[model samples]
Every structure is written in C-alpha cells, then in structure tokens.
Target: SVPGPASKSIITGAINFPFPTLRLTLAQENLSQFHDLDDWGFQQELEENYGRVVKLTGFSGYIDRHLFVFDPVALHHILVKDQDVYEEMPKFLCLDLLVFGEESSLPWGTIIANIAKTMMPAFSTLNLRGVVPLFYEVAERLDFNSISCRTSLELIGRTGIGYSFDPMLPGQEQTDRYARALRGLFVTAFKLQLFIPLLPILMNYCPRRCMAQEGGKLDGSEEGKDIMSLLVKGNATADAGMHLADDELVACLSMILFAATDTTSSSMNRMIHLLALNPEVQHKLREEVLTAPEHLDYDKIDALPYLDGFVREILRLYPPVPVMFREAMSDITLPLSTPIIGSDGTIMHTIAVPKGTSIYVGLAAANHDKSIWGEDALEFKPDRWTKGKADSVETKLPGIYGNTMTFLGGGRSCIGFKFAQLEMKVVVCVLLRSFSFSKPDSGIRWRKTGIMPSPYVNDEPKLPIVVERLRA
Candidate 1:
C-alpha cells in the first residue's frame, strides 16, 4: 500500500468532516487547514513529506483511500496514455448534470466531437484577431478593483456568443440576470459541497433548467460571427446522424459560457495582483506592450515574449483550478517517473491502485516540483522561459499549455484554452499600457473555495488595488 499520513479519526479519515457549526467555528479561528487541500503550503508539504504518490484517507475511513499524485510519468499515463481507465469522477459528472444538464457531459460521444469541430473556427487566430479591439474596448473602461470578473464575462459574451453582459461603461451596473447567475454559480456550488451526493436526487425532484436563452433557428446562409451562432449554423447543416438535439445545444452553450468565465477571471486576477506586487516585472511587461505597434492583433499580442512569459509563469505558479479529480475504472498499476521509498523502506517504481479509488491530480505540485523545474521552482520568475529553463521542463511533462498542468492535457483538456490565452493576453496588454497598479492598503489573502481559489480581504472576496491612469 502507498504510504501516507495516518487518519486522526476512524470516522472522518484525514479530513475534518465536522458539523456545520463546528466547521464554521474552525473557519472563524482560521484553523481549518485540513479542510482545504488546495492550500499552496499544504500541497508542497504533501509532495515534500510523503513524496509524489501519497495515499490519502478519504471519507468513510480506510475503505476510501485516495492517491494524491503529481509524478510526471504517472500524470502522463493518467491524463493521456491511459485516460479511459481514469475517467472523471462520477460525482463530478453528477454535479455537472445537476448544474448544466445531462448533455453538458462533454467527455464522450460523437456530439462532443462535432461540437469541437464546429467551434474550432471561432477560436482560430483569425477569429480572435477580429475580437482584439473589443477586448481593448472593454479593458479601457475597466478600473483595477472589481473589474476582472465583469470584464472577463463581457469579453466571453461578446467574443464567444455575440452578446454583451455589460456595456462596461463607467458607473454602469451589471443588471443582466444570466450574467449575475453565471458569476455566482461556482460560489453557490462551493457552498453545496457537503450535499454533492444528494445532487442527483435533488436534480430528480427539482430539475434545474439551463439558463441560456434558446437559440433561434439558423440557416447555413446566416453569417453569424460568434461561437454559439457558428455552432447553431453548423448544427443546422449537419446530417441527420450528426445533428445535435435542442437540449444538447443548450447544454453546450451553458457549459461553454460557464467554463470560459471563472477560470479566466481568476487567472486575470492573479496576474494583476502579482504585477502589483512585482513592480519591476510590471514595468518591464508594460514596456514590452508599449513598444509594440499601436495596432495589436492576435499575432502581435501573442508574439510579445515578456507578456507570454509573464502569463505562463502566473499560470504555472497559481493555476486557477489547482487540483483536478479522477477515479480509477479498474485495478491498475501506475508508473512513476521518480521512484519513492515506501513505508517499508523499499523503493517502489509503480503503485498498485484498485478500481473505484479516487485520485487527485496535483497540478500545482507538479508545476512546483524542484526536480523538473530546478531548485528555484517555487519562485515567481517569468525570465525562466526567456532563459531557456522552460526548454528542459517542456520535454518532461505532458501539459496542453506551456508544458505545465495549468490547462491539463489529452482528450479531456480545456477545449477553449486558446481562446482563454488570447483573452488574457489582450486584456493584460490593454490594462498594463493604460494604467499602473499598486498593492492595496489592506492585506490580501487567497482562499480556496471549491475547485477555484479567489483573493480576499478581511474575509470578503475582493482584490483591492490602487490604480492610476497612465499619461498618453
């Protein structure tokens, strides 16, 4: 058996599955460290203390053991080579079905394949280049505080679906119900973590409908530019065998809208905060963006080396979703890139995992691994890429973006990653050139809420930064 920390309680395992009151009390005291595995220091401790493949006790005592793995070779096998054997956990699918509907499950079926094919054109460089001005238009109106969330939502709405959630004009309130709902969805889901097992049952009793408005009939002749419109157009022309049903189309829309927003906003928030903290890095990046041609297209924006490195470094160190979960479909042995000494003092190269065992893919841990990224892995250094440090790291790990696990890998990897990158680059470039950001008066702390983490000040979910308009 894989070695890990012993459970303090037979009932709760390694986790503190306390009652609501007790949990609240612990949280109030800031002593609920064990409750959140996504804590950066805790993640590092797991890798440093127990090695890459630490067995963790899950709910329901010894019978429920989970493997917290970040081994590069093991990650390759799980996320790429043998993905079918390590499918998304059932609870995750159930949650998606409850939140977005049954058709939201995009990991399987020819419908997904068709959807990916249809949406490819919309995410292409040519298409994104057309949307760069819109990105700048939104960014120009944004102030440092309370803008990332709304800015990202509006950007996706305009570029992804030809809609506008907010005009983003000064002093205008975001009153779109759908946009507000999308913003609060993850936070609402995070509060319901304890009730995930009952989601399917609750969904049966009270079915949740997709919030996306029904797409009007589309003929192939309609030259709509947005992603959803393109999908609708494609579906209209598709053969009978490949046509997507109405529910499926709605599900796809909701899933795309939801998937594209929060993670991108979180990443953008991290970038801004990091830039504020590192003024020199910010100044250097600003210079790179300022020196570039006034007309910044997708190619020009993507070509900026310092901007690219800055984004990569932020994603590498502080991934929006730090950990992802998968479940073993059958008993299997996982190969490790580096052998670890077992509890019995014997070096083990592979681990035997049973069917139904849960696995936590340690994304942040892998990114911070000293062996792969050298001893300075924990430091925030974008120059690593420009200095050729990324060359060696790229060949060792199987990541879809930047050779880091920020966007994951293989078939189930983020489909709109390119779209996201373009959005971040365009927004950051526009913001950095127009304004300067400095740390806020209050101390900022990042707290993990469900799958994604957000910055907070004095227990409120907020990122306060001092912003000054730059002289033209």
Candidate 2:
C-alpha cells in the first residue's frame, strides 16, 4: 500500500502484488461494449467494478492496474501523510509522452512540480485579463448561429491562436485547412489508442518515424502575442532546461486549448442543458448574476456562493477529467483504514506493494462515493455545498480548497484551476445576463468525448436548444 493514491498503481500491479489488471485478455472479447456507456450505466459499472480497492497482479493485454477503494482515512495517510513513499503511478509516468511529447519520471517525483512550474506562470493576472475580451469574442461568435462542435473547435483555433479562421465564420480556406488538420490529429489519437501498448515486444523494434508522428504544424501565431507565444517567449521557454524541446510546443498548446476551449465550452453547454431541465435553479442563478458587481473582479466572481456551488456541483456531477493514472517506483506498504477482503487483500495492518504497478485514481468514482459524499452522493444536490453541512465534516477528505482533487491535488494539480474558475464565472454572468434559454423541442443529451466525462460531445456541443433575448 503505497500511502499515496498517485503512486499506488505501479506499486500494487507488480508481479509480487495480488491485484488483477482490468485489461481483459483476448478471450474476453466483448469488454469494450460491456456497457452502453450512458450516464447512469457507466456510473454503476464504475461503482461495482472499479469502485473497490485491490492489489492486481500479472498483466492483462494492454492494461496493468490495481484500483484502490480504501476508506477515506487510509486515503489520507497514503496521500498526505506518507506521500513521499508513493509518487505518481507507472501509467501516469508517460503523461509527458502523450501530453508534452516528453518523458515523465517513473516515480512521479518532480514531474507534477514541473507541470506547475511550466504552466502556472501562463495564467498570471496580466495574461488572464488579456484573455477575457477574447473569451467574449469567441462565445459571441458561437452564439450568433447554430454551429457544429467541430466548427466550434476551429473557432477555438482561430480565436485562441489569433488567426482569423471562418470554418464557422463564413468562407475562409485558411480556416478550413486548420479544421482538417485538427480532425487528422484527433483521428491519430483515436487510432493510436487501439494500436498502442504493444509494449516492449512491438514498440522497441517499431519504426522511429511512426513513433515520431507529430500533431503537425498548427498555426501558433496570433494578433500581438498569444499564450503559445507567451510560453515561447516567457520564462517557461527561457527556463526550458533540456526537457523543453521544440516538440513540446504544439503538445503544450494542445493541452491548453483542450482545457480552455474544449472543457470550458463543454461545461457551458452542459450547464445550459442542466438549466433547461431545471428551471428553478436557472432562475436563481440568473437572479444572482443580475446582482453581480459591475467590475467582475476574479474573487468577486468566485464569491457568488450560489453560482460557485452550481459550478462545483456540475463539476462534481459531471467532471471533465474523469480518470487519472499513477505508477509506483518502489516497494512499499499501503496503510489503510479499511482492509482488502481477498487472500492477497488480507487485513494485514498494512498492504504490500511493488514497483511498476499502474495505479488508476478514479476521481469521478471517489467524488461520488457513497461513504464519503453521503447517501445522496449519486444525486445532483448543489445545496450540499451552499448549506455548509457537508463542509463541516471532519473526514479524511482533501479539504475544501486543496482537499478534493477535482483540478487534481498534489504537486501536479491544475495550475489553471484559478483561471478556469474565473472563466466559468464570467461566462455564466454574461449568458445569465443576456438571456433565459430553453431546450429545443427535441430532447437533447450531452454526449461523451471519452476524454472528459459527460455532458458529452455527440453533436460537438450542439445542444439543439433555442434562446430568445431576455428582456433588457
């Protein structure tokens, strides 16, 4: 039992450990279609299968993992108390490979700090303030007419990169080309997922050219200086240290755009869907926005208890980063308030773990856990936050600001956490002020993109809802 949740996987999945990998063997053919992957269906599966804690042993095809469903007290000991013994898990080790086109430390170590270091500066007040006008510009452009999700992504590319692309903005071949490129990259990701994990057998002898296929030539130039340029010119680039390769640029910017455009936009669209269904909550939120102060300072925006609660509830109910991974770097014992029930999971005061284990932390699972969040955990109840009754609980949870690792906690938490909150608050204010929206005649459901969990992207966020200008 590596004390830390981040490093539990690799440690527990080692040959010496007893947990079984979730990756099904070829014999188990229908694994992928195990569930319809609908809202409640997937949630139930997670609760039943991944919801429990175990130390998995041996490999199963592409996956090597040990899910830990230990009690909250045990979670605290591993995460905060004995954090050093555990670092990030093995699966998460390659985050650099997938996200930054770089290498991640086997034992998490300073990787998260590196992330914090590289990205935090980009969200500085000056930089954040600079993005607001652009935020409005982008949102307004999308609101003008019904657009496909892919088109919205193109809009993101243009607005974010400072290019004038009209893939959705009328006829612009330049914009059209960018859209094609973006589609190609997404296709690459989808295909790579199926072919990868050939592991030492195939990857070692694999062609370097194939492995080195980059996302390819996205236009990073914008008006004066975009965030990409800022990073290129800022301290992150100056302090690039050997790890900051030129290859890291597109990937880094990709991640930023994913966070900025995809996650934020998806969230706003979901809020619209949720509100359309719940008129009372919508009315109250609108009322709150109407009373919001004029200046729109970051803190003031965050200070709206009802609004903040609504966002938090939405995040808790429909988190974007549904899952995360970590690898164990060494042998350690996991201290637990709850004991593993199996033979290998015997209630030894502590659990043993080995190196190379892949630990998967289901943030969504833990967030909605019945034991921690109370019986109402499954239901959407924003009042739990506003009421403050849940806040007073003296549990092993991560604490309000840093406790719950939604934006992820630890050295690798989301640096843009503050910025994201500000953006959401601002958008909520703007939309709530401008209109009272409702769903279209045909009922709509947010589809999944598999990256972030729900309020899915089936239509690329075309909610099919109609909006009338609210009385001024």
- Evaluated with lDDT, which candidate comes out highest? 1
Summing lDDT over every window of 10 consecutive residues in candidate 2, give the lowest-scoring window: 202-211
Task: Give Cα-based local distance difference scores for all models.
Answer: 0.74, 0.52
- Cα lDDT tens digits, model 1, 160-182, are 77678899887888988777766
* lDDT by residue (tens digit), candidate 2, 84-137: 665665333333344444453334545445545766666676776666655555
Candidate 2 TM-score to native: 0.70
Q: What is the C-alpha local distance difference test score of candidate 1?
A: 0.74
TM-score of predicted structure 1: 0.89
Count of residue pairs whose backbone atoms collide, per candidate: 0, 27
**Which runs of model 1 end up more than 4 angstroms from their true locations?**
16-19, 22-34, 37-39, 103-118, 143-145, 193-217, 220-222, 239-242, 387-391
Number of the predicted model whose TM-score against the real structure is largest: 1
